[model samples]
Target chain A: MQVCKKCLLNDNMPSVRINEDGLCNLCSTQYESRGIVNNNEEEISSLIKANREEKYQIILAYSGGKDSTYSLKMIKERYDASILAVTFDNGFLSDTCLKNIRTVTDNLDVDSIIIKYPAKKIIRAFKYIEDGKFFPRQSMERASAICNMCIMLIKNLIYYEAIIRRIPIICFGWTPGQVMTSKPLIKLNYTMVLKGFENIKNIITSRFGARYEKYFLDDAFMRENEANMPYLYYPFVKNNYKEDSVIEEIKEIGWIPPQNTDGNSSNCLLNSYANQCHVSKFGYHPYAFEISNLIREGYLTREEGLTKIGNVANPCSYKMICEQFEKITG
Target chain B: MNIQAVNEKLKEFFENNFLYGESFDDINGDESLIDKGYVDSIGIISLVAFIENAIGIKVYDSEIVPENFDSINSIYAYLKKKMNTQDKAV
Candidate 1:
């Protein structure tokens, strides 16, 4: 029950060390000056402006979520950059999220790719994810297993789309809360990515069979196009993350608050169920780790962090999620 | 901290937290965890964050390559180098 005074991360997480000063080890590290690189805004701008080859300068891994909607607006308004917005419809997106995707993309003149698989296959993949132990244990601190599965798949599909198209920048509207890294802009290391991809390949292919294997990059494709694959950019992580202002700003465009999700998410209807399952097994809210970063970065107060993670008791939306899922899987 | 103790802790952490129904008892220390499918790209991100948080070392973004982090032996060697550098600075 002990939460850090400096940030809202509780003692239940093994990585948290709430010291005598009442600051958690994560926050307390600030005094030691680790000198991590944060925000390559100028570099990102220069990179984007300099790259004139691709028709769409950045292929955004859009989730039709609040963050991506706002990022689309910013990238368009600021750089006047051409963008290809991509969404992986996991069959669990709230009705509001779907509508927001249409409204925002239509108004912004942003082209889109909605990657959707057969509903039965997608649901079966999710069922495997929900069975637990599908991903790294540390990722459980940040998101539920189901959410992690969705994110991993979405990222892969986006990467595949980007590489095939030879897009220069694979951008994600990841929140500062979500991506706590100091470096927002990252050059892709093909070797490291390939090495890391083995785990994902093993988990998904082993469970989903060869049907899902085509989602990954193949050696033949890499032999021809590996040199042209794009790097990734996270604009939200590097910029000031004022959620209140962003919500207001994005509201002017087309986004409306999703009705079916829990407080921590506005895109996925499965969020409440995922949060409950994650907390039931892990002894802490899944969003607590990610939300704690928001508090530390001044985007949210400790009370707000506590409130966000405190929603584990939200009426079980598992039935509601299943209703929508069954409608499709049938 | 003793090098063996640090290695043990690192291995213990990976096994307890990163395994997926596979037994780590037989995983060779020199084998690439990535190649063996014990760790993946995203898992390595978490591992790096854990190393930074638990070991209190500022891992340069460049140091996140497989050369320094792909195996238990490689990670221990990397950590020893980093700690030595810190100590010399002190």
Candidate 2:
């Protein structure tokens, strides 16, 4: 268990570099060279001003997950924007997560909405996902591909909601580990949407079938809505902190754990299985890249980060996930 | 470029970038690169860029679609089709 000297990432993270001075590469290159120190209140003020100028009635993509929950907290307490916290309500939200969602939002007074996808379709998709029926195992394996689609469908639905509401910004709590940020945020342009949709089509068709092209594809609409709606991140700063300390600080703002879970998960029960599947298949989780980046940034120690991943092997949680799979199929 | 030259270029480009060790003899144009696990999302972006650069024909932002760029063969056909239409317009 090794921790980076600077950032919030641990050694279990992949694709990290520690310089001779033990500085994380991300912090050294992106932060120091760009000179975008988090303490520069002027930049924060400008970011807030730019966000306000967009006339953004934000639709925060909430999942009762920890990151999203924390993101919502930041929106209200920090930015003070007009934010609507919306969850996809994927038919399997733990009662604990639902409760925490209520707790956090009520405390912050952010408007909340939960839209449920058709349960049977979600189940069928996950069944195939867990059963490993998808093809072209290059981009994703069975478990991850299914999870990615679940998130993708939710993202599209959120976009539609944004269009109807005339909301410009669709804020997601995606940290760098989950996504790559060539630009911190940019408006969803037509070309980007077309390219993204095309890539997604290849992913689905190769794995599911050509029949899904009509159902899953949405190039036409995304292209039509191509306007400048920048996706922003706050965690791009504050990469240097211990997990417990960060969680403790956020808890002060009324963020609490969902019921029936431990530190490894703050939202979904299925995550442990997802992490396990990734580790078993690729010898690491897909999340390894970002975590490694965080470590390289000197935000976390390798020891602490490895501890977080080590918790991915809780037997009770693993059994519960397996049991749920059986119950759904039976 | 002649059709044969276009096909040869695609084969060479894929071998160099995809590095899958599969030769032109192994892959037919119509077979789905995605379906056969020969390419992934990153590969799709790279291939689209490669086609644009090599053929000197721009794939308009709108023309990006699964049907148009599903495989190396399909991509070649797409470029050829677009080239013909452009020539007619000219």
- Per-candidate TM-scores read 0.81, 0.63
Backbone collision count in every prediction? 1, 21
TM-score of chain B of each: 0.80, 0.78
lDDT of 2: 0.58
On residues A227-328, what C-alpha lDDT tens digit does candidate 1 reach at each position?
776777777865788878989999998789886678888788778777777777767778887788788778889887777667663364667766756675
The list of candidate 2 runs beyond 4 A from truth reads: A1-56, A130-143, A197-217, A227-242, A259-264, B1-90
DockQ of every candidate: 0.19, 0.09
Task: Assign candidate 1 its CAPRI class.
Answer: incorrect
- Tell me the TM-score of model 1: 0.81
Per-residue accuracy of model 2 over A194-224 as CA lDDT, tens digit each? 4444555565567657655544436666656
Candidate 1 whole-model C-alpha lDDT, 0 to 1: 0.73
Scored against the true structure, residue A299 in model 2 reaches a CA lDDT of: 55
